[model samples]
Target: MDSSSLIASPSLARRSKQLFLGTRLKSEQLDETMLPKRVALPIFASDALSSVAYAPDEVFIMLAVAGATAYAWSWKVALAVAVVLMAVVASYRQTVHAYPSGGGDYEVATVNLGRRAGVTVASALLVDYVLTVAVSISSGSQYAAAALPALSGHEPTVAVALVVVLAAVNLRGVRESGALFAVPTYTFMAALLGMAAVGLFRLLTGTLPQVESAELQVVPAAGFEEPLTTLGLLLLLARAFSSGCAALTGVEAISNGVPAFRKPKSRNAATTLLLLGLIAVSMMVSIIVLANQMGMRYVDPHQLDQLRTADGSALPAGYDQHTVIAQIAGALFADFPPAFYLVVSMTGVILVLAANTAFNGFPVLASILARDGLAPRALGARGDRLAFSNGIVFLAGLAIVLILAFDAETTRLIQLYIVGVFVSFTMSQLGMLRHWTGRLREVHDPRTRHRMLRSRAINAFGLALTSVVLVVILVTKFLAGAWIAILAMAIFYFLMLQVRRHYDQVAEELESDEQDSVMPTRVHAVVLVSRLHKPTLRAIAYARATRPNVLECLHVDTDTEETRELMRQWQESGQEVALRVLHSPYRELVRPVVAYTAELRAANPRGVVAVYIPEYVVGRWWEQLLHNQTALRLKARLLFRPAVMVTSVPFQLSSSHAALQRRERDLDRARPGDVRQGRPPRSFTRR
Candidate 1:
């Protein structure tokens, strides 16, 4: 049989895969997969935008520890987060233009700082991306539970299911996933922004009403029972600001995904970054301001002990504490039930889709790492759909583990959230600073120098701000959960370094030398025979066709009767090759064959011993277990012998023909990415 006949066709599993992930795309369609600005905005910016659903709540939750009195600082904290958000956005605008190759912060750090620094940034971003999916999906699950009470205790399950769904959508291809996600992202924007506008209008017109929690009192925590001093208040606000900086989580995604954008990739990416910053900051500040205006009080969902009724008593038996956005939506659309549900439902949907940002960014980052030999090469290869499927599945698996580990609790996961992002943020800003400084040195043109100087200033400010925020996050959250993220980053950093080292060592060891061009002195072919069957005869025929200096059939005397019968059949059939038998007192088939091949190699040290073993090509998977047991074992042993070449001579069964036909049909079907990969469709006729 020809080599093509050995190929297995599409099975039931492949059909199921195609059913879920959609049809595979040819490589030439990669350009068609590039995203327009509209789709790219939602795909890359969803995490940042979706943070409005929870970031403001985190601010309120932190301040609520000091009782409702501390709520006065909520707007200021939101303002701080907004300022940081804008700075990050502006800094990354420079990044997309400077490093439009989609390396994002890692590329910047590696180029301007060093490989170690780049790896540091890459590690941080990788951890951050996993946390993004974890936090976003967990937060979304929380919102989902609030909307559907039946789902309250099942958030982890819901979160995992959501992760699986998102991964499947992403496996379809980047453009397809983006197109699917764009609507929900835009709906979230409109819903939240619309609620903000309406809330602001009501406040101006003196028609605004208090939220359901307005009458509830926020009881002080154990340490904050008394009034806080200035220092205490400063520490409290710092913690709140750090938690609120979740708004900045997805900003770097745009920089990392510049290559995915359509024409004018850099400009579109920068514009998307600007839009993300504006929309996110506006939504976040609006939610905080509106929550404060409506006398909204929120505590950690798990810490409901801190919340009390107007009577200062925990009297309610089944009172649900909805999310900050839910409360705001309820108040703003008190009479409009549909609008309220719309806002809340879309909030949940967007939070789930927010993880899509990580889905898009993580795989691209992993692929880049793979290309640089810092990650597994599989991560760098495009799947049937032209997406980094391995990286996508890997990220999903990590995120699901994190979600389960944290019990899909957003508050708990949020504590571990921003540390890695801020690490990447700080490193990226520092790298950009070095980048602009180096550019300024090279640019003699007056206009170019001026532009470079302006960019440098932006990066300088971003560096200063992000460095401060990183310090605050470490101080306020290290014990809370940020240490876990830091440790994870450290682990990833070490792993990537080790992977790169391994690849380098392998390349060095495999480097061609002058001796590689030399040929062996002669070929000594040996065919292993177990019985006088068609497969055994085929193996002998193939081995003889090579016209080796010496040809022989090797049989192990595992069973004396079988060996004698094989010799009788060999003589009766008048085979051309000489029959040789090795005695096996232990009744072992593989060991005797291995000993003979090693003896042959040792005898003719400069010559090669080629061992051809007959293998059955069975169509059914179960049929495989029934055949080729001895040949497999023998080949495994022979492979380690010096100057030995192991070859499988496949004898096709009738069942294998079915597999060959199926394989041919699959080959005839044109796949999506084939044209781009220079593999055009071709017809095949069975021989």
Candidate 2:
């Protein structure tokens, strides 16, 4: 190798390493304190808590269509939805106890039902994770507008901004943000209870007043006469109740995150499940009750004209409808400005933070799927803190796409919600039943038998309730947009099955053969040269360095002029090797190369053909696109030929110098044993 080539090798290696930075993590660094209960709740259950932010708003919005008469059903629907949530929480609590390894619904279904069912559960949960971010962020932005008037008419911008921020925090690692957010998440619950108590006291004293906007009349959309039939009214009530049940969406997160909990993992997970459900239920019920008392009315943003002014004229355009929790905050803190803003601000912040649950849950679940060989191996890659970095980026891309597509409107996005939650709910409860049945035969104690039986009954009831709700969500929302979610689930299921098949096929192919250790009968070295440049010279030298027999220079003769000149030059230079030019009338590279290799392999079936091609190494990442077109294609075609081996003899040009400098700087900034490694990479440490 020349002096210039020697320098280039180190430069190219340095740059190649940069693409892989921040991707590798040590497993040992992923420990328990990384997931304390407070942070874990926000990290895992924020999706559930944030639902209370807008689920109540939807309840009031739908009911207000029928005038004040519809307000009476708010608490009833909230209680009914809570019953389902409580049952689901109880079932998942059993799930965590039964399977503390952290696969959650997907694991449960796979263990009990089989692989297909597990894939179904996985697909469902994947869809749910995306919806969790979309719905939560959009709803949070809705709340943000109420607290700060400047945010009006910019809901999508605010929602997407929040999603972007949440994605960054989650990509950093779950434990870090969990520790940071535990107080704020808990405060959301505390604030809801405190407001509920204050509202109750004011009600008892006959001093509770309605919200300022609540008195504005809500004219029903251009649909039916005011006096409706019992069946029509009940169906509308069912639709409203089903929408409200979005509050139950994130209850299964604890089951998914049991492995993140402290020792006595099952117990801790179960207790967390209980805590999340109770807190979510209380907040949901309180908001609904308060909205009803305040006489709040809302409608689909597109149907705002339905809400008329007191004089029977249309309410003005651009009239902002504050959500239920916002309305309650405005009413309760009418006298306390700071208290009012704090509740509204945190409520908005918590909504965005709620997406954190999806961010953490998605990557973890994806890693499990990848480990099981049912997803792309990239999903298995962990971050510097041993978190699933690829999975986080994947979730962010999906959420961002959905946000942009739907314009981050909660009203439109809400239609796609709840389907994934119910799918997992029904499947998990079924898995739990199978779980208890499997455990019953192994247990000898009578107390154990009785407790198992009780758990089974609760799960069975939960299954029944969730099944009904799933049907209701589908019936009411399928046309409205839930079909898109169902389609997404189906697509994910099939794609995962294909991934598993690919992994299995690869494993089978990679299995050792009896002749794997055998040396080749002959090593035929072919130096593929396109031009007489530094890269070509480097390729020839590298191939010669290997010192193989039957060494020859092969070129695809696309045009007459280049091949003749190359041959003349080879002769004039008195080169030791002969130049063999093959004419290609079609001027194609990959096909002719493939055909040539096949011919060589046919002549010597037992021999190995090692083809060396010179490739350019560039400084800027984008500069890579400008080079290596033919070599990349050649490598790809050669890969399919089992007998042919391809090697890249990279020739780094001076343009690659910048990339080398950047890597050297990065290495210095984050050297091993440096204090900057405040958190070790968990992925590398684990394996």
Candidate 3:
């Protein structure tokens, strides 16, 4: 058939098109769904920006391991972390330019390194994506619980619900969800940066107040009271830097989502990456500096005994310590309580929105992996909303599982978070170095070669810096729960390999062969008669309509009386087809039919056996349960048999007709603009 003729045929296209229209977007509408820079920033940068809320706490918490004596190094650690962030951002700009297809690290490593490198990057990225959702939402839920005491005990539930809601927004469409998230994202940036500006001005004017925790002295962990050895101090510093590197977790997302941006996708993505790095660094440094100036003390909540009063006595009962950001905001805005509340509220909202970046990045990366046969093919498909629905659901489900498992505690989850992201970061930069080296060999122009060389140098530096950070993270955090993330990465890596192997095996087995192209010798048809009802009659009629070589009515004698009555009726009705009954000693329904079909197929090895089973189409829930049970089992069994075709001839009952009419009414009731603008009906699937 010609393409134009196929398009014009209603019978061939209408039903199939209708089945998918509501759940899938048309190929032509893809461009309309592309995100602009304004919307793309929030969609792709929220996670990085939101990291500022908790990264500083992680830094201080690590320093608290050695007590208040080590707190002076917090700002220096933050500075080092900021420097690393700049290098990563610069490295990723080159990545986005080279790979504007939204593959991110996985693509960079695959093309420049090798398949194993690509799979490793993919596994790390997938794990990081799940951790981002878990940590972000969990932290957000923590802030929310603090704000509303009633929610304190239900943080995990709230976190899971936020994940579900975020998934729904993302499944709606990228541009649409981006637009929705833009408000809170922008609000958060403004609130945080504004707080920083106001607090800095207050400090310059000599009016800044100390934090509430400033009065409490932090007791050092055992053995830290004595003078520290060189090894101990170095390990403490490494631990602090590794913890602060949490701010760098989401920086790779912009590169992963380059294709989602409008025209000049690479340039736009690069610009967004720079903006993310600058904003995140600024916020993180500001928070860290502010915390230092206010003398904020952060420690594991379980180790509350480490905090003592000014007299070196223990704190009073129920002395709950707020987060570093929370303490800073409260101390900075002591007089203006509403501003503190605003900052707190926006911080929580922004943290939840931060997970949206993962929602955006994970699917795009998964789609790339799927295309490369490293993941399920379903992850590669776009839904009715033109988003990767399967990947989104998969990420959300994994995140929810993690949240529930960890009781929505950010501190615990954060330990497993940065390892994967940094692994991808270090490997990606190394791959970029290789990429630039290969490109330099092919380029002859002086200016272009110089630029390529400069880019290669930047990536080389990024590789060195991130490599150190990755080592530090593994060393400092390995025993402290980071091993879970490494184990998860290993699991995903092998699982993808298995999935790819299965897909390859299926593809090779299904490959066309000239020798196997010949037609069947003959077609033998069998109509399964469960009862002499309207459905059975319809099935028999449909089977006869096919006009096969030989036809017979088959029945399982599960009950002798019923079989006898059916056979008598067949004889009295004078049917041309003979009734074939197989007596079942065990009185089983599905097994007898399966055995008969297999026997017939074995007798005619070269012939095709087509089985027609009567199925009722009912509307009400209970009615549906009452029918199709036996037919479903028979079809399921016959589907695995070679040369056997099971066709369900559905006899629509009166309720089914009503249900069809109701569906048509719902279709007609769609938004007027949807029809007027030539858009198809939207799928009600919430992804």
Candidate 4:
């Protein structure tokens, strides 16, 4: 109500929010939160679109296991992966249309298959999103190293820093972060598409330059040198196909983020999904084809004969294996070096932005799970920027830990990449099959039934294909590192089940309807006094204001001199309230208070005992530490006693008033539109 309050309040509130979330937004301002298609494409599709940077390399790495002889089939593997990508995109389009609540596979499975199936899908998607961040950022760091040799040996540290930066950006809100990322996403797309076009043009004109590694002969693994057996070839091709399918890992992100779209959410999301599929598949297939036409060979950096000059002699040490996109760019732009650098730079930027897709999808999915009682309820709450802030930080922490553990090596991380996604894809498609089957049972119209059957067929085909890919991925990458992902999924699944169980048990126990609205027989009030001071006098007055059936002032005698002085002061003050001293021979405070409260509760089961403690409300941080520690400890110990309620009679110092004003300003700024929700502004109330 004062001028200083009106001025200082807003400034302090703005400073607090600017320190944390950079800006403060009102509740009504959230209507502008929906994303336009251009922004949404970058946010929801970055993971899939950026996969082209590393998916082809994964394919080539698997093929290199059998040496260059097996590289001939790499394009076939890429094509097969592209087919699966199209199927998944098509299937998820139906999902977004049918269930646009942003739950994606978890919602679909729960609605169609069952709760267990839903939990299974949720678990897999959770693991998939985390791996999406790890693999994408790790690969981005690799591209960074290639672009700047000075950063060659610090990929993991660079990757962690990138994650931290991304976490900060996303904390700014979905639409804001989306706008921030749009340029990089689109530029990366244009760079890759332009490079692919130029590479294809040169190839058609028969002027395509050979990659640096084209002439280097790959030394095969021990068992692969001789003529391949039937089983050996099948296993090798399966590995290649499985690795190629990493391109499909992030296709579900659009489905998970359907709610973040503008008007006509489902249609926009489906369109985005289609665009993601087309762009990703085209770039992936084009990169693999160009790499093949240019006779490029990608192998593990530690592989034998990875580098050889035109004379077939070994090149010098510390030679980095640039990524698939980098190699293709180098080959296509042999005469124009900047084009290659442009491609590489954009590739690295996009790969880092790729994690933004996971940042968007994971928190939304976790929010849904939290709403359904599977995750911590805090994850369901939005922060100052109206984003699921807790979930975002949780994901960033998990990803950073994984990056540190794996040293940000894409080769090791990619092995753990596609397993969870394929599990989610297979189960989601299967759930959709059941969804359509149930719909067919209800649709009496012939035309509608026909459409249902068609959708069912599509989902069924997706189910079969993804199921087979899941099996192949599991078998081929199990020991190679996929087991880590599988174990993670299993752990999340069981943990969520336990969380749901705990929530259920808690709900059942807290169910109200009570024993005919029974009331306590009487109210017994106790004032905890440390000394005869204004705070103690205030506590006594508040206790008297309650007009309880019984009232007493209690003090714990920790020191004889202090207790005697307090007794003499009470007598001299002529206080009517009787003061009782409790002996604490062990020099304890909280224990004696807790025991007395418990004893009172036991003695009067039908009565509610209210314990009022005097507390100091301080503004400064160190001032807070100087006071309230004892009051907080006592309150914590007293809360567990049945039929006992603890109250704090706070004595506000001058500093406390300042803190109160700042808090009021913050609340006012944060909930400016709370009146629309029929709630009054937050103002301090005094008794």
Predicted structure with the largest TM-score when compared to the true one: 1
Task: Indicate the TM-score of model 3.
Answer: 0.92
Residue pairs of candidate 3 with colliding backbone atoms: 23-384, 24-384
Instruction: Give the residue spans of candidate 1 off by over 4 A.
Output: 1-8, 11-14, 640-642, 662-687
Cα lDDT of model 3 by residue, 415-482, tens digit: 89899999999899989999999998899999999999999999999999999999999988899899
Q: What would you estimate as the lDDT of candidate 3?
A: 0.87
For every candidate in turn, the CA RMSD to the true structure comes to: 3.0, 4.9, 5.5, 4.4
Predicted structure 1, TM vs. truth:
0.94
What TM-score does each of the candidates earn? 0.94, 0.86, 0.92, 0.93
- Angstrom error of the Cα, residue 392, model 1: value is 0.8
Comparing 1 and 3 by TM-score, which wins? 1
Clashing pairs in 4: none
Per-residue lDDT of 573-647 in model 4, one digit per residue for the tens? 999999999999998888988888888888888889999988766676666544446777777777887788988
Q: What is the lDDT of residue 242 in candidate 1?
A: 93
lDDT for each candidate structure: 0.88, 0.80, 0.87, 0.86
Give the per-residue lDDT of model 1 (tens digit) for 1-687: 112123456556787888888766777779989999999999998999888878888898899899999999999999999999999999999999999999999999999989999999999999999999998898888777877899989999999999999999999999999999999889889988999999999999999899989999889988999999999999999999998998899999998898899989999999989998999988999999999999898998878989898999994777778888888888888889999999989988988999999999999999999999999999999998899999999999999999999899877788888888888899999999998888777889999899999999999999999999999999999999889999999999999999999999999999999988898888999887778888888888888788889998888887888789889998998887898888999887777777777788888889999988777787766676554466666666766777899888988888889888877777777776667666666662332
lDDT of 4 at 476: 94
Q: What is the lDDT ranking, best to worst? A: 1, 3, 4, 2
